[model samples]
Target chain A: MFLKLNEIGDKIAIAASGGKDSTVLAHIMKLLNERYLNRKIFFHWLLQRYDYGLDLFLLSIDEGISGYRDDSLETVKRNQLEYQLPLKILSYKDLYDWSMDDIVKEIGRKNNCTFCGVFRRQALDRGAVMLGVDQIVTGHNADDIAETVLMNILRGDIARLQRCTFIKTKSEETIPRSKPFKYTYEKEIVMYAYFKKLDYFSTECIYSPNAYRGHARVFLKDLEAIRPSTILDIIHSGEAFETSAESNPTNVTVPGVCNRCGYMSSRDLCKACLLLEGLNRGLPKLGIGNTEKLRKKHLDEKEKSIGEYSSSKRTPGNPFIQNFNDLKLGSDLKKPL
Target chain B: MKINLEFSGGLELLFDGLKQTSVVVEDSSLKNLFKKIESELITQNKELFLKDEKLRPGILVLINESDWELEGQYDYQLKDEDTIVLISTLHGG
Candidate 1:
């Protein structure tokens, strides 16, 4: 933990989601703060409203589990009351209004989970920045990291494999994000949670359709079953490799305030603005670029025209003569001298 | 230089998607190497690469242990024995 803390300074906020990993992370941060040198350590619990289609019954059920409909708000309130840490909870109701299908159609994402992940990241970053924290810590344990590594390999995403390793410090125009449990395994975190009896929600997100990651997790579990140290081996193997420092260039910082909603982004409009544009235009699939379908349609039209012309005229000369007559008879054509 | 590269989690799946195990390039710039790799991927699997006139988002590139987003984009220069890791952001909880 100390080694992990060395990477992040004293002023930090733990993103608590009321889940096992986050709860354990918050606890560990608190314990470390108490045992270590005297400094006013700040911990903020950040949570998002997990919208499940706004059914009153469902919302009531959610409220029953976490005193409030929003998990982040509840976690933050608890933190303030129990741990006495400066906490803030933010909520956005847009997710409930927009279905996973709606988001996917607008963003070209396959599932709701992808949309949620991106939205949550932006929300957390903005929230943390507003709170004025030096570093933002997440409960991304070893298992999650390992699972991510496996998934990235499967998807052939080279950039993600390189970037996912250590705690992510902010790039230019980005907030500094860190993961203290990057080295800590999921099992250890879970074990610690269970042993310490930390209060956390055991239920998975209702809309997590991560079949690919699920397969990776299962594959890793199978390998770990054969060799308990296999997880560590994978982690060490990831640590051993390095990416070419030159290959990754920072994104060109774009200058513009978002027209739809004011948010800092390099593009003239942020992703959210783009999504809204697509939605407003009723062209949810506009940006998805189903180029294959378009290509196929174009080929079909060309083939159909060719077939029509060839069938109508046995000699290619006849088609040319007909075209010449049509052009001559056209309104723009003048009489021949 | 023969560099042994390893990918974790979703990144390992890239090997399945790749036609070659290691990329051999005369140039040493990370940008050039990545361009070569992207070209190879496009040539082999045009359907995947040419989706939206660019490589799909959510995929990340890493040099050594740092994220390309953190280090630099494709412009990062490659040294002898440098390993590049490609991963996808597919993690969900």
Candidate 2:
């Protein structure tokens, strides 16, 4: 299934969460690279060879959620030595100035996962940049993909549903991310990790008690119990639908650099930047659903001072200078205008 | 029957964060073994690992390094010093 590894570049970061899927993936990739790529073989075998002269790193994100991410990161650090791979750690505190704990305290637990998820996605990219890796590989397996497909279908998110089944995904601006375990089963992964006695961290996030994705996962697990093939079937169905990433008229969000952090984004500000602004300014809701109005508000305020607002332009918002009460949402903050 | 049981991939979280345990049982069936483990080991969230008198859907059971499905799932007889492994495949990545 991973004969495609031959195409991967010289250096890549495995987005390991110290989970079963990634632990197995890391071991398998290293095994294949050593056994297959180092030898001179026949033409057919060469095509199947996985050697890309790859430099491997374990990239882990610390959401600073205390017991959860910190515990998991310890396992990642152990694997750094166990797997003979270097490790990189990026924290939400450094990236966005808010840990999941702090975000939860402000936003309330209801929507903090959204902040963590969005920030973690870009944090991986930024961590890759710091590590000097051009490609990022995650341990997303068949079950994960299927659950995402179901969730996207439930939410009527066609663009994301169509893209969820892809083995490799990259926007025009960000580093490429791939999932080699796309065809592997969660059962097989755990089994392999167990029989091999690989170390991993598995406690659920303390604050993730009521995530909507949890429902999708339970539904998918039930379906797998009845028929194991259902997971792959959902992925195949997802792949059957076609949604153009570029020309989707309804969701005209195209890739651009964030006006705040200069990271890849589809809007003036990336989700991380917007969420950071919300956290620092005490308006965590500003980063959640329907951010369009808040984004326009930022631009309009900028326009009043400069007399002209620029689209396709980057605005440098002051995250520290604006001050209100420590937890105040809107007033007395010395607004940008 | 004396058995060696191991739980992992967060399944251990149900067993008070224990990854491995050894127990002696008077009854030898896998079902009784599960009940014994539940009564003796499971500290909390019993339902996360068991449902409707069966192991939960996402937990994989292995006996002596082979899938329990190959060796008669819950009916497999436990032997002295037999190794049983239960791994949960349910957590997010």
Candidate 3:
């Protein structure tokens, strides 16, 4: 397992959330790099390959939550100073022009997690691309992964159920992200950090009640208390579930690029783009659940609004509709607004 | 006996945002201490810390900087000046 760090790469980004798991992960990786990686002699360089010392960077996403993320970012900054690693902090306001605080205000607390989860996933990828790192490592421990497996199964999300068990998730469109603490229990992480006197932030997000995952996590923890191996067993069960295409035809989705943001998606618009559009249009619930029906209603309203504008001089409110107008009326509206 | 109690991973929020507080209590198993905290120290959301008359499933208990699981869990007898840390893993990383 020690050799696995050597193989990951020269430049890696740690997705430090300023929490116990990620803080300890950063500390351990730095220790390994200094004590082991720096002293290793490279024999593969004889075959025309050059070797370099390990480079680590701290990447944090500021979801723009006031009390939660703001305080956590302070801890990340301290970690950068302490660990001597380059740190990059990205915010949703910068990436998507919407912060979690703004999202919660616009959409309320009910479905804000949907937006935060989708946006944060892409925000990390965007941050990794900006850093030009070889790989991104997160602080997802065994408990988190097992809870995700249970959630996917409960939601009947077969695609995510198959993918959630992976220690490393890589695809053509995304930066390869791995969980180094995949098998480590949360208790062990907290204990290690406490003993080491590592600095970390440990406050829940103000906007996240997150009842669904909380229930699943409680259930998993209860099972773990009884058997102690139930977490890994559930993960193994998730890994063992094999659904042939014939057996699960509806869940299969071909990966494609979103036309709006050019991110990977099964449809023309990715979840982030769709949610952003809904928020932009003053209809924050459009992308939450049963989007197809809401989307049809939106399109019908757009068509009626377009019919009212006969001059073709007026532009539509949605950029997507404006794109259509730009293509149809190529030279008409190009007369400088 | 006096024991140092450390609340973290958002459990401090329930304890008026106080991370470490030394509480005076009689020598007893760690199980009895749960009630002492819920009644005296914890200000709200007792369910987050204790559930089903036991330490909540997601809450981790450590005695003297070692996992409580290693020291007989709730059955372990408390010692004078022992550092007991209660960390809630329910928070997001």
Candidate 4:
């Protein structure tokens, strides 16, 4: 599925979560790159358009979920040594001044998934930036893409329903992220990991009682049990959707930079910034489900905070550290300011 | 009947962090082997592994490295040294 590997830069980072999919993916990527170099390209088109020079790095995020992330980072580190790749680890505590454990305390487990998911997305991009790698590959497989497609449909999120099926996702400010195993099945990944004896970590977050996705996944698995092709069919149907400016003119907003952190965002403040603002201000519910209220509240808050910060010459409303300069990650965890 | 059972994708956490175990069971089918494994093998988080007398939806079963679907699913007759791999795809990627 990632046939365009030749187009990527020499330095690429694999967003390794140390799960079965990622462990298998890290090994497969190395295998493919080596095959391409040894004149054993998998396809005729690859022989014409392939290059053999790519440096791989293993990048992981520590969500600070006590046993979950802490255990997984160990697997990632092991994979780094096994794969002979460099490793970089980032944490929510240092990046956002809050961990999943702390967030679950402030907000219940109900909406903590939203916080963890959004924060992890932005954190990956920022971590890639720190590593100076613009290309990132994740382990999202056919099952994941299909589940996300169903979730978007269930949520009536036309924007993401259209975007989730894409093999590669990118914005102006963020790294260009691709999924090498986009068309690969979950069973294939698990089997590969098993046969190769690749070491990985697997444990549910102690606090992630994510009901919505869990339900969707169970429903999809039932369908898959009846007909294994249902997973691919859902992904194909998602790709069949066509959402353009003419189709949804007013609903779609042009992507722009987040005024607070200057990250690529459809709104003035990205979801991460809004969520972070809510957490730091002790209003953890501000960015939870149905963001219309958060959008309106953020507008007023942003303007007022921008004005306040323009005079103080500091970051607008961010509570962790004034700016990235004041923040340090990777070595020691940062405490909330 | 002798069977080789391997658990992964966090399901092993419920099985005392044991990924691989060789068990001798009374029955020769996966349906019966599951009951044996659940009752004797799993000490904690039994609900995570089963619901309504069936393996949970997000969990996958493979026979000899092939999809269970290709191997007759839960009804596949077991043989000596058969490897039944159980993995959960529900964990966060």
Off by over 4 Å in 4: A5-9, A40-47, A170-173, A244-252, A291-302, A307-337, B50-53, B62-70
Per-residue lDDT of model 3, residues A64-152, tens digit only? 99988999999999999999999888788766667888888887889889999998898777777667787898899988989999999
Q: Which ten residues in a row have the lowest lDDT in candidate 1 chain A?
A: A51-60
RMSD, every candidate, angstroms: 23.6, 6.6, 6.0, 3.7
> lDDT per residue, candidate 4, A122-193, as tens digits?
878777766777589999999899989999999888878878988887455566888888899887787677
What TM-score, to 2 decimals, does candidate 3 have? 0.86
lDDT of 4 at A314: 52
TM-score of each: 0.54, 0.86, 0.86, 0.87
lDDT of 2 at B23: 95
Error of 3 at A300 (Å): 7.5
Residue pairs in collision within model 4: none
Q: Give the clashing residue pairs of candidate 3, or none.
A: none
Question: How high is the lDDT of residue A119 in model 4?
Answer: 88
Indicate the residue-level lDDT of A315 in model 3.
44
What's model 4's overall lDDT? Answer: 0.79
Task: Write down the worst ten-residue block by lDDT for model 2 chain A.
Answer: A322-331
Candidate 2 lDDT over A274-326, as tens digits, reads: 67766766677877888788768764565343222222232455332221112
Please compute the TM-score of chain B alone for each predicted structure, in the order given: 0.61, 0.94, 0.93, 0.93
Higher-lDDT candidate among 1 and 4? 4
Kindly state the fnat score of candidate 3: 0.80
On the 0 to 100 scale, the lDDT of residue B1 in model 1 is: 49
Point out where model 2 deviates above 4 Å: A1-9, A41-50, A244-252, A297-299, A302-337
